[model samples]
Target: MGFIEEFKHAYAGDETHHYHVARKQVTCLHCGGEDFDRGSALLNTTGLTFLRLDWVNREAHLLICAGCGEIRLFLEKPDRV
Candidate 1:
């Protein structure tokens, strides 16, 4: 699976538990890992969108692989289930 499937798996499990994935679940570039921890990073810019002020400045959502420590970033946050 790619980020899509991996993300789905992560949010499907225990809320407080670490992500659990199988082989070939998460891969990007030369990165390969099964589990990930999610978070956000602030982008250096100006403005705000959370309050519908502007889109010039926004945060990037990301997932860090538990196995290889590789970080995957997305312009839009992944959906949660």
Candidate 2:
């Protein structure tokens, strides 16, 4: 499934018991819009910097606004095993 669909599934299913995703009050800062496109924050060069620093433990989540293309970042804590 797509990132957004996966997010919706996790939010509505038992997957949320083990994982945390910030879907609350997420809006576009630039356009003040409520619609967004979910994606991986590590899909870009910026997230690659963390890999180079051995900081790959954490995962960065991204929400791209459908209106003005504003991106919001949310960092996930490292998983244990």
Candidate 3:
């Protein structure tokens, strides 16, 4: 598999879910897919992880597309669809 495929599988654990952003159904920008796996990502700074201060950074909700592994970051939690 390619890098993107590997990355998606590495983080694959949550059950697949459907979500919506801004009242619009979430679609994978890369693959135009609608199924996703919910995840969260920390908006880390350049040197925060090494400094052991990464937790101080903000977090964005993620929706990993099941079809293309495309990740979407949201400042606010997306509504379930």
Candidate 4:
């Protein structure tokens, strides 16, 4: 699917407002700022092990504090695969 479809698939039918509520609880570690610029990282890996399917690529969520430019990268919690 496309980007929008992928997002919908990930969140199911839940609204993103819940994320806003959770966001309110976040604080920058460096400067203790509440405001942040959020984004996602699309990553791809193609090393020897990855080529042999020993490793898989995944996306990361980024939270950058506006005040101090400190960044936090969030990866999904691992589950049984």
Candidate 5:
């Protein structure tokens, strides 16, 4: 299971959820296209042991366009959660 898959699952179950992502972009920088494919938001909890938090949340998107084969990122707003 990947982040995108997990995100979709979460979305299906409930609308309020958390997602982690490195960066946020509306369109693909490479292709400059608006079309995007939805993906999962997976958390990478490698560090943060000191904070007593084992996991760091992340939201990721596939953001791909079939016409140009471009990939972008989709981000969630704080209010959305």
Candidate 6:
């Protein structure tokens, strides 16, 4: 399987994984107008061991606003329980 598939599988098996997404308005802090476009990095992390099969770390997506050129970033991971 590809890297992405592997990551997903690991996340599914790890209950301690901290996976979450943060949503922010892509409007200027001064002016509330939705207008933005941005790029974000993808990241994934996995444990190193015989249980390496149970670890994962990777990027998901980018946040953008098509109104006022505002851009937001996102970095999500499974929440640790």
Model 4 scores worst on lDDT over the 10 consecutive residues at 1-10
TM per prediction: 0.48, 0.47, 0.66, 0.47, 0.38, 0.28
Global Cα lDDT for candidate 4: 0.46
Candidate 2 has an lDDT of 0.47
Best by TM-score: 3
What is candidate 3's lDDT per residue for 1-81, written digit by digit as tens?
A: 221211222244656878988898999888889898887755546445555656663555778888888788666788877
Look at candidate 1 and give me any clashing residue pairs: none
Candidate 6 overall lDDT versus native: 0.36
Poorest lDDT segment (10 consecutive residues) of candidate 3: 1-10
Candidate closer to the true structure by lDDT (higher is better), 4 or 5: 4
For residues 1-81, could you state the per-residue lDDT of candidate 6 as single tens digits? 232322222222212211224433334443454433334444434322333533433454343444443434444532222
lDDT tens digits by residue: candidate 5, 1-81: 222334343233222222224443354567666444444555444323443444434554444453475544444432211
> Who is ahead in lDDT, 1 or 3?
3
Name the candidate, 4 or 6, with the larger TM-score value.
4
Q: What is the C-alpha lDDT of each candidate?
A: 0.48, 0.47, 0.69, 0.46, 0.41, 0.36
TM-score of 1: 0.48
Model 1, position 49, has a per-residue lDDT of 34
Give the worst 10-residue stretch by lDDT in candidate 5.
10-19
lDDT of 1 by residue, 1-81 (tens): 121222322344433213322322344334554456676666443323333535633556666766666777666554432
Please give, for residues 6-74, the per-residue lDDT of candidate 2 as tens digits.
Answer: 222112322211122443466667888766555553334444553473354334665556678766666
C-alpha RMSD by candidate, in order: 10.6, 9.1, 6.8, 9.2, 8.2, 12.2
Clashes of 1: 0
Error of 6 at 46 (Å): 17
lDDT of 4 by residue, 6-29 (tens): 211233332221123233456677
